[model samples]
Target: MRERPKIKDIAERAGVSVATVSRALSDSALVTAETRQRILDLARELNYRPNVSARSLRTRRSMSVLLVVRDVGNPFYLDILKGVEATAREAGYSVLMGNTESDPARETEYFNMLRDGHADGMILMTGKLPPAGGWSHLPVVVALEMIEGAGLPHVQVDNIGAAREAVEHLISIGHRRIAHISGPLPELMSLHRREGYREAMRNAGLDVPESYEVRGNYLLESGQECCRKLFTLPEPPTALFVANDEMAYGAAYELRRMGHDVPGDVSVVGFDDLYLSKAFYPPLTTVSQPRAEIGHVAMELLLKILSGAEIDCDEPIILPTVLHIRGSTAPPRQ
Candidate 1:
């Protein structure tokens, strides 16, 4: 077997001193750009990989970032994971996925990893704030979801605006008796989306009877249960605006089970157009946020923080959302 290529070999082949090669590999400003490029080119040609463990001992950086997700099993997180992984690799960093499963204990365990230098930084998708003290110095970025008053850098979408637009789409198609299936009310995203739903309803002069809104856990089961409750109302809703695609799938599934044709008997809209949304039965109409972009941008922001750049955490970086009109929605039957 060929011996692993080393910086020593690149140094000899590039006709530079080992010290110069070292500086060049690190991209230290002390090395001229021309010399750095030459060394880098030679390293690439030789497949000369850096000894990360040795470098970590010298620099005290694990050179990996942690991505803490509320639930790694959720399909919604897949795109974001791709984005994060891609960006991290380009920057010569590896990623650690911390699946907290929404458990405070697991979250704290991952937080300890960051504090202990197992990872250089963290991109938080758990939608929860860290413990109050000793976290002021950690490099952390929040993604996809927001934590109000957390004072951390964020990469998220306009939940309220996106949700309002979704509901507005239903209203445009003559859906007056519109109901909402929301994520857990305690979540800020859910609250913002629910607010958007209410705002659109209020704007259209529609009375949202208490029965028209149901709290769901952003799961298919909750969507099914919520849909059952809503249809039992004295005046069933003509349409539904679900907070996430999973719940929307559940809602649509239940609608079929109850002998209703989607968009003919009732229209439905969902947020976060997961990959499955396009292939699901009737192809759900939903709001599509830049899920992967959210991960990419969040990782970039964390990298900036890790590089000692002073990032202002005061305001979040908000991305846009697109409302994809699909077969699940249309003009509501009068």
Candidate 2:
């Protein structure tokens, strides 16, 4: 086998300087797109490989960001992760992953990895804050979840508005006694959504029945249990709005198990229009959060921090949400 080609050899063969070849290979700003493409083609032809470790040492960057989520398998988070992955790859960075599985201790352990420089930056998608011990001085942290005190900047959607919109959609279709299956109460996201539900009900001059709203953990089983509680009430709600898609599926499954037709006997709306929502038995109507865009924007903000760019702390970035109406929602039975 022949020896592997070096950058110098590629530069000589391409008739460009080593610096030009380097910029072309890395797709740097200095190299025009045409020049970069030509250099890249030559490198591919010559089978030249870059020494990532050496380059990292020279640049003092790992060129990687950490994305920590509670459940990596969740479809909503997965879409967001894909967005983050694509954006990071385009920005010439790799993504390091950490799964907490909702375990706070594991989350704390993973967070410690950031302090030791395991990743250039971190995108935390878990709702739990750092362990109540110490760790109040890390850089470039974004709370993609409802976690408070992340000690870094963040990007969040209007949970209140999104929830209100979902609820209002149900009401516009003549749903008065609508119930909400809420996520964890202490979480800012959940609290905001719950408040939105209450606010919408109050604004419409309807009685906000405490018993109609049930707390959940954003889990399937919690949703099922909440559904059971709502159905058992003396007066059941004709419509339900679940906090997330996973729970919405659970509510739908449980409702079907009871021989109730979705959007026929009851209408349902879910949040975080995950991929699963579209493919579900009856496509779920939900509030679509800019899942991947959230990840991309957070990473971009972190990149700005890494570049020593000053950001105004008072102004937090807020992404918008949309309502995706599907087969799951309709006018409640008159």
Candidate 3:
């Protein structure tokens, strides 16, 4: 019977140490790309297969990562999930998804998975942390949203800056009366975006009335509800800056139902430009978040953490955002 190829065989044929072969196979960054490629090519030629189960037993690692998100159904997170899954697969790790829907018990269960070593680490997108187990000494990466004072590695876009830019766009188009539809306040993202909205309005020498800001649960229905309350006001806004594209879509739908023309009766701006934003009736004007990139980076950061490597930078990795000015926005009607 022929013998199965082993790491030792690859190392011997490639003239590299067994440790180098191991590191390269594990996708360790310590190995140079050239060396890793060479090792991989040799491994393929030799028909070498990794014994992940044996390795996991030796390292006492589950060989898996946990990705917990607030809402699995929201397309806002679809690309992020893809990024994480792809990166994990490349690094020879499996990803387990937890859809918490911002539920306390569900979140705690996922946290327990990490604490109990069912997974090596976690990438947390839910705004709140575990209520009981706590996050101390846990390997966690915050993605899409930052949990202030958690002091963990985070990957996200500058919500305040992005929101400010979206709002400012409305102002630039001669919108004097602009309202904001924000997401839930508990999430730092929602607050930061609202802060940006106020900042832009303040900078433009405009007043933000208490009624001008309405909070939603980052859902389509809530956005529709916000529009209902806003449009009834004695002085309804000529434009709106919604915290997310889902809510923005809802606002646009409701406005049309209410007999208002998008960008004709009311201009709209949205954040987290979801995929469908561009294809909508009047293509949405929105802030485009690097969803897939954020996920990919967050997973990479987690992999580094698991590898016991010191991250090059201790600060949160902030990705850039772009504003897509499309058919949804124009100068407010006279």
Q: Please name the candidate that would achieve the greatest TM-score relative to the true structure.
A: 3
N/CA/C clash count, model 2: 0
Model 1: lDDT of residue 176 = 90
Query: For model 2, what is the error of residue 270's alpha carbon versus the real structure, in angstroms, after optimal superposition?
Result: 0.2
Off by over 4 Å in 1: 1-48
lDDT, residue 242, candidate 1:
97
Cα lDDT of model 2 overall? 0.81
Cα TM-score per model: 0.88, 0.84, 0.94
Sort order, TM-score high to low: 3, 1, 2
Q: lDDT winner among the candidates?
A: 3
Which residue pairs collide, candidate 2? none
Span of 10 residues, lowest total lDDT, candidate 2: 135-144
Assess the local accuracy of residue 7 in candidate 2 as a C-alpha lDDT between 0 and 100: 90
Question: Against the true structure, what is every candidate's RMSD?
Answer: 3.3, 4.0, 2.0
Candidate 3: RMSD to truth: 2.0
> Which of 1 and 2 is the better model by lDDT?
1
Residues 138-256, candidate 1: write the lDDT tens digits: 89999977888887898999899999899999999888999999998788989999999999999999899998889998889999999999998888998999999999999999999
